[model samples]
Target: MQVYLVGGAVRDTLLHHPVVERDYVVVGATVKDMLDRGFRQVGKDFPVFLHPKTGEEYALARTERKAGQGYTGFVCEAGADVTLEEDLQRRDLTINAMAQDADGTIIDPYKGQQDLEARLLRHVSDAFVEDPLRVLRVARFAARYHQYGFDIAPQTLSLMRSISESGELAALSPERVWKETSRALMEPHPQVFFTVLRRAHAMQDWFAELEALWGVPNPARWHPEIDTGVHTMMVLEQSARLNATLPVRYAALVHDLGKGLTPPQHWPSHRGHEKSGLKAIKAFSDRLKVPNECRDLALLVGEFHTHVHKALQLKPATVLKVLNRCDAWRKPQRFEELLLACTADARGRTGFEQTPYPQAAFFRRALSAAAAVDVQQIIADGHQGKAIRDKLEQARIAAIAALNDAD
Candidate 1:
């Protein structure tokens, strides 16, 4: 049997990029042949094994045929007769279809190297349309390699648009969709992922709330980038630039969903969008089974991002009230993430990319002063049950007032 290093390992190696994992394809091998050589079978749907010593995956060279709907509805053939070229042909992108031999000789049957040099993401074959997941995969690759100036080929984008129009995207599992989305959010140019998806019309089934923002108007004086969708993408870009956590990035993404719900008559003025956006955030979170951390932070940012933006002008008591509502004392880290999301929003507007967000630092100082209030002193001064809680609130508010006065 001949083993060839395949898929991402080969592709990244050619690009002089860091390889995270190595997967091998064993051609001219049977299941028994792998087992006899002390490899452990791991893949449930196909013949994949784990090397006894290295513990890396070693999947038998296999070919697939579309048998039904969705990504999972496929019949696989991993017999000894399956050639390396046939296995490569079944892959989604040309760059991902190339393989390398044990002697480090590169194999480029589908011109993956040529496409790589062109900085283009092209499909391996027409079989690319068989799996709907490729649409998200291509978008993700676009985001990941965007820093290197790579773009999706026009023909491949046309196939993605066809897949989007076919209603096949709805058959994909929510978990899988979120997996790709969350990973894409962490990429260097996360905004490009959604842009590509929107371009391909892939947002109708899952990201309709975000898609609705494209044509929506915002107050030009405040937004500069009057299109709500443009501002949201800018926010996502700023979040990545700040190197914020995943929850913060997610919050930045959905902070303006309320703008989508604004009546056209209101035009440029979404008076209650902060609270109006909570519904969209909840629907998105529930549909995608988003983690509580991400969903909760997004909800907080959606409901109170405006309050954060206007922090410098608010009364000390109002600032304290916002903090209490956000449960800042109980979950300080989440509160910090909310501030970062808000900061991203402040910097996301057109012509404000490098603008400083003093609101975040002000909020941090206010939180620190309020949290430093002496609760034990209030309890020691003959304050009773309800009175102690009341006195603590009053003291915290006073502390915030002192901080505001100093500012």
Candidate 2:
């Protein structure tokens, strides 16, 4: 049996990128042949084996036939007769379809190298439309390689649009969708992932809340980028620029969902959108089965981002109230993430990209000052039960007031 390195390993190698993992496509191999060699079978739906020595995956060269609906609705053939070319043909993108031999000879049956050099993400074949997941995959690739100026080919984008309209995306599991989304959010240019999806009309299936933000208006004075959707993308971009955590990036993404719910008659003014967006955030998070960390942060950011933006003007009591409501005392890291998300929002507007966000530092100082209040001292001073709690609150508020005075 001839084993060849395949998929991401080969693609990344060609792009001068770090190869994190290596996978192999074994041609002229069967279950018996692999089992005789002591490889452990792992794939449930396809013939994938684990190398006994290296522990890397070794999948038998295989072909697939669309048998039903969605990405999993496929019958895979992994017999000894299956050619490496056939296995490559079944892949989603041309750049991902290339393979490399044991001798390091590059295989480019689908012109993956050419497309890679051109900085284009192109589909290997018309059969790319068979799997709805490719739409997300391509969008993710665009996000990952966007720093290198990579873009999806027009024909491939058209096919993605076709997949979006085919009702297939609805069949994808929420976990799978969220997996792609979360990974995309961490990419170098996460905003490109959503923009590519938006261009392909793919957001209506799962990201409708975000999609609805595109045409929504915002006050031009506050958001030089008057389009709420544009501002959100900018926020996501700024989050990435700040090297923010995944939860912070996610909060930046959904922080403005309430703005999309604004009545057009009120045009450019979303007075109560901060609280109005909490439900949409919950619904989006619940639908995607988002992790509690991400969902909770998004909810907090959605509800209090405006409060954070106006931090310098808020009274000390109000500052303490915001901190208490956000549970900053119990979960300081999430509160920090909330501040980062708000900072991203403040800088996301056009002509405000490099603008200062003193509010973030102000909130940080406020949290620090309030958290430094001597609860033990209050308890030592003969304050009992309810009185201790009240004293602690009063002391924290006083600490924050001192911070405000110093500022």
Candidate 3:
């Protein structure tokens, strides 16, 4: 069997990044051969092996057929005649289709290197329109590779538009959607994500709640930005500045998505937006089968929207209690990520320049102290802990009422 380095390893080599691990496609080899050669088999949908010495994956060169809809439903054909060149053709993007043999011979059937040189992400073939998931992949690639100065091929972009309109996206399962979306949000320019998808009219299918916000007007005094879409893009840019994680970044892009779904209201009277964003985020998150951790994060960011606004108006204790209601407060680093996203949300409005929190240290101290809050020391067992928790909740409501009362 001939082993050839494929896909990202080849791309990373050209980008001058350290190719830490390599994925090999063993052409003209059977699973028996791989096992005999001390490779461990692991893939379910396809025949794949792990090298005994290096533990690196060595997947057999194979072809796949769409036996059903969704990412998990593909049927594969891996055997002796399935050449390495054929494996490269089935890849989503041309820039990711190159392969290099062990001796350094380049297999350049798709001219991926040329496309890389031209800063272009083009499809291997017209078959790209068949996998609706490729639209998200392309959208994420546009975001990640934007810094690399790569341009998506015009025809490829057009195909993405076609896929969006063909009900292909509607057939996509939630987990797949979130997988791509999560990856896109973690990338450098997720704003280009929606921007690219919008041109394809794909955003309507992927994030319809956010799409509904396309032309909604914001209060001129606070939102100098044209519409919700513009505000989202600005927030996306700032979220990247924070270099936030997939969930945090996803939350940032969609934090205000609830605004569009609510009834028309005047400037800043958002009486129930936190609750609204949570509802929307949960609905979308469930459809996407978001992990429990990210689902909690989405709920927190949605709830955090209200907390940050209240923090601007009242006692820090009130804000602390509100933040405590969120699971994200449990994360030391993500707390700062929350504030960064919140500040970006504020500044991204139509007419504002956000000031970095001067009270950042104070808030950290407050939260840290809250973390050390021991129930047994405070009183006793379940009775005291439950009582304290209830009291805290009541105190938070009173503080919020006071703010509204003052207003």
**Best-matching candidate per lDDT:** 1
How big is the positional error of residue 236 in model 1, measured in Å on the Cα after superposition? 0.4
TM-score of each: 0.99, 0.98, 0.83
Q: Model 3: residues >4 Å from true position, as ranges?
A: 18-20, 264-271, 310-312, 315-317, 320-337, 347-354, 359-362, 365-407
lDDT-superior candidate, 1 or 3: 1
User: Residue 7 deviation, candidate 3, in Å?
Assistant: 0.4
lDDT score, candidate 3, position 258: 73
Against the unseen true structure, what C-alpha lDDT does each candidate score? 0.94, 0.93, 0.75
Q: What pairs collide in candidate 1?
A: none
Candidate 3 per-residue lDDT, tens place, 236-299, comes to: 7777776666666677777876777767655334456677777888777777787776676666
Q: List the residue pairs that clash in candidate 2.
A: none
State which candidate, 2 or 3, has the greater lDDT: 2
Error (Å) of candidate 2 at residue 336 is 0.9
Query: Where is model 3 poorest over a 10-residue stretch in terms of lDDT?
Result: 357-366
